[model samples]
Target: MAQAEGTYDEAQIRAEYADLTRELIARGLQVSTMESATSGQIASLITDTEGASAVLRGAYVTYCNEAKVKCGVPAEVIRAHTVYSTQTAEAMARACRRSYAANIGIGVTGTMGNVDSANPAASTPGEVYFAICTGAGSDARGEKNHSFHVHLAPQPSRLMYKLAVAKEVRDRLVVLLAEAAA
Candidate 1:
């Protein structure tokens, strides 16, 4: 199989970002993100389009366990489910929403190769976990609303994986927002 050095669909991402920002602005909703494996690529993509400031509250690049915990991911959850699991991702999402007072919060965590030997909770290379939360309670702990889990087996280049994950996150956010709008 051919390996893509970097295969981000900029046009598609731009369209999605435009639509997402428009809908959020229309509804007076704010969005934020907690990113790990993909670093801040998700937030970067969202902020790339115009009018993003209206809906984007900023993001936390919680690529480390400490950062994730500091941002609102429970330490116990990480211990129990590992930082790469859905549980941690959900917690991260909820925390972002609460901390940023955003209507929508997205958490993305996974291993993008060069796994940290110190973290036994790290997942297989290219395995990613995502959670999108909404209507988070006033409590800083927050609540989980939605989740997406996937593994890009035979993972492409690190850059390709990040782009793929960003695209997935964007696509999922669009669908969730559309559902809420209905």
Candidate 2:
């Protein structure tokens, strides 16, 4: 992909989002999202595409622990593990599916706070986790994909990092949706 001459490669990101949206609708699936750290960037990108309403259900920009709970994420789950863990992502995906009645639900969380050397795990500023919930029955199954410790250099700035993460999430979802359809 040719890099756009801007802070973010908006053209590339939009192209990927369009493809993902097309594939999701073609597969007769709908999607919703619950997000943190990346804020609502992922949700915004999905909705920005035309015909998104056909397969894009809704999104919860649950940037706070309280918001996550209000959005249907179980309190016990968040209490057991902080919002940055894989388990939290799974819970968010499951909750999004139930709340929005979507065929696929995406949950994303990451760290963007001050990095503390004392807490090595919190050092990475762009670590993200994504979960995709599938199936229709009450006992729906979902899969979790982690970006692990993505350490974006300081030059990109926080907004750029978030945009990059949104693009990555969209690209990954496209692959997963295609695989599921196959």
Candidate 3:
């Protein structure tokens, strides 16, 4: 679907979210999230859908590296990866699962705006990393997980960028859930 000048496709997002919620409910799986760049938007979108409580365990808005570390993301991992790499994303997801004991854990982190003095040049704006993890039953030691990195060049407005990232995260989760169901 085409996006307008500076807005996201809310209708499409809602429809997709509905499908996601349905699948999670059907599978009797619970999900939790630890978000950074997109803050808690991903988790918010998930819970906005009907029947969310059945599948959504909880969510954390770890906007700062300190908060990420507090929530289980290893400080060493963040130090090495700048809190924007796939490693940090994976660690955040694993931590979410361990913290909530949920079947699925999601982690989102990255730069969402123009580079500033405080922001490292290596972390490009509109570049985001998403990690989704599933507990492998008896062994919940962070074995089964998936991570994706996306670059939205010519980035849109801040709100639009955030909306787009949230949609991508939701769509990916749907695919993962479908594959697990099959």
Candidate 4:
């Protein structure tokens, strides 16, 4: 079958999400999500699709450090690696997996700090990290982290960066889930 081609639009995202749910259901798998900056957008998108209950276990929008810790992210892990770091993303994924007992779990973390040059260089305003983890039952039982450093130079703003980061993370996860199922 030929794959569809287009930039991510609402239609494309919905279609991909539907496909993901279908594949998971067919395999008797389930998913859980941990989100920070995206603020539950990914989870909401998945649940918006019909029949998502078959594969979507639940989602946690851990928007605060305390919530992350409460939801199973270790305080030491957060201290060693900032909340926006890839390590935090991985921890979030694993924590979600353990908490929800889902076959697959995903985590996302990011920040939209001020763009001033003096700010910490390790994490930029538009940088986002994503991690996908499969449970012990799956062959892909590990975490995958991806970072998007969107340097929207001339037109940078907190809202713009946040939206860009969220969209990119969602689109990438859709592709990753499809590939993993294949």
Give all TM-scores, in the order shown.
0.85, 0.80, 0.88, 0.73
Name the 10 consecutive residues with the lowest summed lDDT in model 2.
146-155
C-alpha-based local distance difference test score of model 3: 0.80
Query: Model 2 lDDT vs. the true structure?
Result: 0.70
| TM value for model 2 | 0.80
Candidate 1 — which residues are off by over 4 angstroms?
A: 1-8, 140-144, 154-156
lDDT string, candidate 3, 29-77, tens digits: 8889999888787777778778899988889999888999999989999
**Candidate 4 global TM-score:** 0.73
Question: What C-alpha lDDT does candidate 1 achieve relative to the native structure?
Answer: 0.79
Candidates 1 and 2 compared by TM-score, better number: 1
Best candidate per lDDT, number?
Answer: 3
**TM-score result, candidate 3:** 0.88
Score residue 63 of candidate 1 by CA lDDT.
Answer: 77
Model 4 residue 62 CA deviation in Å: 0.7
Pick by TM-score: which candidate is best?
3
Scored against the true structure, residue 140 in model 2 reaches a CA lDDT of: 50
Candidate 3: which pairs clash? none
lDDT of 4 by residue, 14-62 (tens): 5666666676678787888898867777777667767889878889999
Residues 1-182 of candidate 1: C-alpha lDDT, one tens digit per residue: 11223456667766777777777788888888999888888788777777889888879999789999888888999998898888898998888988888888899987765566767546676677899998844554545479888765444577667778877777788788778778
Query: Is 2 or 3 the stronger prediction by TM-score?
Result: 3
